[model samples]
Target: METGIYLIVTIVNKGWGDTVLEASMKAGAEGGTILLGRGVGIHEKQTILGISIEPEKEVVLSVTYPDKKDAILQEIVRAAELKKPGAGIAFVVPIAQVAGVVHLFHQGSQSNSEETK
Candidate 1:
């Protein structure tokens, strides 16, 4: 168990789940998890008789090396088309501890470096 692992938070369009996964993998993520959610923002509303509307979303979580996290996040952003409206957002968090994967962490770091080259 160690602190300093990187976690990527990617929120994308509802139907872009597969695209996010492919992008993260291509950018050096071993794997990822997805969760369904709803987006709430200033522009996330409709004016139908003063009614409000919010769009559904998909949140993709990829935990990787501190080094690879950036590239993985970038890939998700690009692939998910987050630059467009309603595409969602992405970020990274530093993990304080993890278990059952000491060796894998080392391997992930090595692979991350290699991929960046």
Candidate 2:
């Protein structure tokens, strides 16, 4: 089977996981998984005006069809306001094979084996 499968990973402030999910869903994403984490940047140990802190962040992992990848990514970016520095960052990677999600899609859409979600 040949398909265009893409995994979108978005990282943002701890409280922004739902925001990303909502935005993505509106833009055609079915669902995603959220993970909580603590991040240490290169400047994490540095003092900002004499203050140091460890920041907590949320990671959202979404998988989608190729046709919906760009729209979903853009919505997440807009909702997260990631254009500004330090807001957050997102990237995409392709998946060569996938399983356990075959039941989530509608039957009519399964005809084209080239782009199953």
Candidate 3:
């Protein structure tokens, strides 16, 4: 089955997960999941008082339909300033199948039914 679902994966500096989430929602995404992580990019290497510190990161996962994928990604980029070095990165992966998101499909179908009624 072709679900036409895409997963928008966004990785940004720690504490910016909420910004991504809100942007995704504003672009029509239902919701998203945020996970804590740590990594250092070439532009992110730094030292604090002679001590090196690994940068903390937030990984945001937003599942959305094809129609909203581009808009959601653009919003995330604008909100997170991803164009800046070391700011963050966002990408999309097409999902062949998914589970536990029946509510989203159900709501879409309900609206379609109402429109036809």
Candidate 4:
């Protein structure tokens, strides 16, 4: 059995990172950082009038407890509908150690993302 922290990576069309992070938070995740990326798959590119068009993608990276990894991953897949091709993909990588999060990386983050209304 894998132990220690696990990194959850989710890649989807632009603007979907937020949705994936939201679902993870509800499943015991602290938060995630989003990065912009481009896909290079055969079906990812399209041409219009001889011009090439590439779809923008969002990559979300987050760390969570190993025990909660499965739940968080499941929620992300369900929320992002990754089961369908071309929607997106998600995976987990085991981590040996993590540092520099002492400043702030847990429970409080959920409130920080909450809207004040």
Candidate 5:
């Protein structure tokens, strides 16, 4: 298990995934993963022609060391304007174990990546 590693999950409007990724990277994260999702938030409800609309969302996951967590999250919030209503949310969770991302701990090691294949 890897201690001191955190996973920052940021969910924002569809087109902002790239912004979150860029922000996290600028704040010292190596990279992040973006996933497509759909849901309607209380402040994001919409309708057109008497039909309901479910907003599309982008789920961004950034894994980083403890030291980089705060900076990355701050940048994400600032870049995404998360403080405003319907701007989306960001949170962090501790990671118990990690694999296939050896580069974060070992600059040149590829063992974990190779073993997976």
Candidate 6:
């Protein structure tokens, strides 16, 4: 596997942004970016009746060491209560390249591992 970090973004129902951020941070993430969005799914009924449903959402993005991805994801899931339906979704995307933070990543990894051990 190529050695690099990952950025995890959790898109959840509105008002959960702070929870996600706190969870990630508690799991060894420094901080993250938050964005507002609108989610659309099954807006109308199949029958003749016309009904619409839209969900307001918040997207929380965080970057962390590849080794810490799993912990961070779990924290977010629990904090956001993602197990329940209509809560939200979480996913990770690989970061092929980065700059100016290699040292920070190494230091954080060391600190976290030491604490765990």
Give the alpha-carbon lDDT of every model.
0.77, 0.82, 0.88, 0.80, 0.89, 0.79
Q: Which regions of candidate 3 fall more than 4 Å away from where they truly are?
A: 47-52, 107-117
Q: Which regions of candidate 1 fall more than 4 Å away from where they truly are? A: 47-49, 100-103, 106-117
Segments in model 2 whose C-alpha atoms lie over 4 Å from true places: 42-52, 104-117
**lDDT: the better of candidates 4 and 6:** 4
Q: Write the per-residue lDDT of candidate 1 for residues 52-97, one digit (tens) a residue.
A: 6667888888888778888888888898888888678889888765
Highest TM-score among the candidates is held by which one? 5
Which residues of candidate 5, in runs, are more than 4 Å off?
Answer: 107-117
TM-score of 4: 0.78
Location of the lowest summed lDDT over 10 successive residues in candidate 3: 108-117
CA RMSD for every model? 6.1, 4.0, 5.0, 8.0, 3.4, 6.8
lDDT per residue, candidate 4, 44-68, as tens digits?
7788999888889999998887678
Error of 5 at 85 (Å): 0.2
* lDDT by residue for model 2 (20-57), tens: 99999999988999999877654345458877776998
Clashing pairs in 2: none
Which run of 10 residues does model 2 get worst, by summed lDDT? 105-114
| Model 6 lDDT on a 0 to 1 scale | 0.79
